[model samples]
Target: MKLSEIKEILATAEGVNFKLENGISVPAHFHVTEVGIITRDFIDCGGTVRHEKVANLQLWDADDHEHRLKAGKLLHIISLSEKVLGMEDLEIEVEYQAETIGKYDLGFDGENFLLLTKKTACLAMDNCGIPAEKQKVEMVNLASASTCTPGGGCC
Candidate 1:
């Protein structure tokens, strides 16, 4: 979700909670270690120049189990980051380390903020010469008895 959207959601939530797309919850004691704007500039395989910017929130499961980030506190931190770093209202990307560090897109259900699983996508599918997936057909459901027999000339 966008930065503005989260701000509104935070206003109503009791605390900051990040729910993973797999139905796992990032514990309330988790610390938002970093909040900064990330700007990535690169050239796609299609020879197109691209730039991306997002507000990043890095969550770390800290040793202090009593720490629970409240919505208001997070909002204040965000504001401070904005003022100090000149950050803008960009989409939020969360970085969390489970088995390893993974970047995710941010979202929220009615009751919980969500960390969506990120996947690699071809930046230029058309230029890569990868064919589109073919439509699936169920062989068992088709009437193919005539074509199966050796004497069925229709084959």
Candidate 2:
């Protein structure tokens, strides 16, 4: 999901709810502590230079359970961020701490916003020295001494 997408969603929703991939929900008392743009620049193992940019939202579970973030209020916050920070319509990356500080790709599953797990992959599979995984082979196809074919077998 992108900033523009969430803005559009917030425009229509009655409340803002975030659901994890495990079916747990971010508490209604959660606060969106931070919203900003993140830019990453790095070199891949394949020697390719790359850059990525995303709008980041950091959700912090707070002690206050009285305030539930309504759709309108969330939209208002986003609007303020846009006006003050000049954020663009970049994809959203959410930071939430469970057992660890996990970063996730943001998405929506119709009724609620979903936190999709992100993974790091080798971008240069072909350039890497790692061998490809071997395919499973039938054991019966092996020429064992016990099963040597015909008279040609010295066994």
Candidate 3:
């Protein structure tokens, strides 16, 4: 989700909640420890130059179970980051602890914000040497369906 999109959602949301794609909820006591822009600039394997930027929000699961990050409070944090860091309406990437620190793409499913797993893809597939995946074709027996006979004109 874009920065603007979350801002709008937070405007009316009663409370802030987050869940993994698997439906496990992030601790309600979780804290948003950091909010800022992350940028990547590099050349792909195809030698094409590229750049990317996203708003990063790091969630920390603190032991302080008494604390809850309210929707308005989170919104304020985002706004402050925008004001100070000149952050644009970039897509949000969330960092949370999952065995190790894992990054996720942010999404909302009506009530709880969802953490979508990020996947790597070859941006330069056409330029890379990797072979295209072959299409799967199911084999069918034709002997039983064939109308042709040794001496028949149907052949």
Candidate 4:
């Protein structure tokens, strides 16, 4: 999900809820500790330079169990972050602590925002010499007694 889309969704939502891909929900009292734009500029293994930017929302569970982040409040915080940090309509990456800090891709499932698990991918599969998947074929026994022998002209 993009920052603009979340802002639009927040306009109509009453509560801000985040769920993990595993159906586990982030604690209701979780705090969005930081909202900022993250820029990554690096070289891929394929020897190509790449640049990426994402809107990052860092979620933290605090001791204050009574705290709740309302949709409007989150929207306001997003707007402030945008105004102050010059954020763009980039894809949102959420950082939440599970057993450890995990980064997730943001998504919406009509009712709630989902933190989709992120996986590592190779950017240079072609250059890395990784073998392509081989096609499989079933073998049929054509050497049956009814079949012509190889010495026959039918070979």
Candidate 5:
């Protein structure tokens, strides 16, 4: 989700909640410890230069079990980051602690925010010589019986 969309959602929401793709919820007492803009510049396997920017939100769980981040508070934090860091309407990437720190793409499912699992993909598939998917056809649809009959001169 984009930063603007998140801000809009925060405006009407009461509590902030994040759920993993597997139906597991981030602890209610989580804290958004950091908010910033991340920029990535690199070269793909095809030697093409590329750049990406994303708004980052780092969630941390502390011993303070009573702490809960309200939607308004999170929105305030985002506003401050935007003002000071000059952040744009970039996609939001959330970093939260599981067994270790994991990064996720942010999404909303009407009722709650979802933390989607991230995956690595090859941007230069053609350059890397990956074969294109082949089309499949049924044997029965291959040819007409009149075109290739048993013991016929055509066959």
Candidate 6:
């Protein structure tokens, strides 16, 4: 999902909830610690220059179990970030602590926000040395096929 989408969702959302792709819910008391733009500029292995930008929302499971980040409050923070930082309506990326700080793409499933896992891919697959994936075809045995005959079961 994108920044604008979330802002719209927050307008009527009764509660703010986030869940991992695996169905594990983020703690209710979790806090959105940061909202900022993340920009990446780099050269790929295929020697192509690339750039990326996203609106980042970092979640922190705070010790204050009583604290629940309300939808309106989050909207306020987002509104401030936009006005103060001049943030763009870029795709949303979420940073949450798992075993380490895991970066995820944002999604919404009608009722809950989803933190989808991110995967790396060769940006210039055609230029990269890695071979393209081969088409898979299931093999069937024709060796046991019946032969045409007048009255044989082999037919």
| Candidate number with greatest TM-score | 3
Candidate 4, poorest ten consecutive residues by summed lDDT: 139-148
Displacement of the residue 146 alpha carbon in candidate 1, Å? 14
Worst 10-residue lDDT window for candidate 2 reads 141-150
| 1 against 2, candidate with superior TM-score | 1
lDDT per residue, candidate 2, 4-76, as tens digits? 8998989999788998999999998899989888899999898999999888899999999897888888888
> On lDDT, who's better, 3 or 4?
3
After superposition, candidate 3 runs with Cα above 4 Å error: 137-155
Stretches of candidate 2 off by over 4 Å are: 131-155
Give the alpha carbon lDDT tens digit for every residue of 23-139 in model 5.
Answer: 998889988999999899999999999999999999898888999899999999999999999999999999998899999999999778999999998999889888888999667
lDDT of 6 by residue, 1-155 (tens): 98999999999999999999999999999999999999999999889899999999999999999999999999999999999999999999999999999999999999999999999888988898889889999776566645644576665
Can you give the TM-score per candidate against the true fold? 0.84, 0.82, 0.90, 0.86, 0.89, 0.89
Model 3 residue 117 CA deviation in Å: 0.4
lDDT digits (tens) for residues 22-128 of candidate 4: 89998999999999999999988989899999999999999989999999999999999999998889999999998899999999999989999999988988888
Off by over 4 Å in 6: 138-155
Candidate 3 global TM-score:
0.90
Candidate of highest lDDT: 3
What's model 5's TM-score? 0.89
Local accuracy of candidate 1 as per-residue lDDT tens digits, 1-155? 88889889888888777888888999879998999999999988888899999999999998899998899999888889989999888999999998999999998888888899888888988887888889998677335655466666656
Error of 3 at 142 (Å): 2.4
Clash pairs, model 3 backbone = none
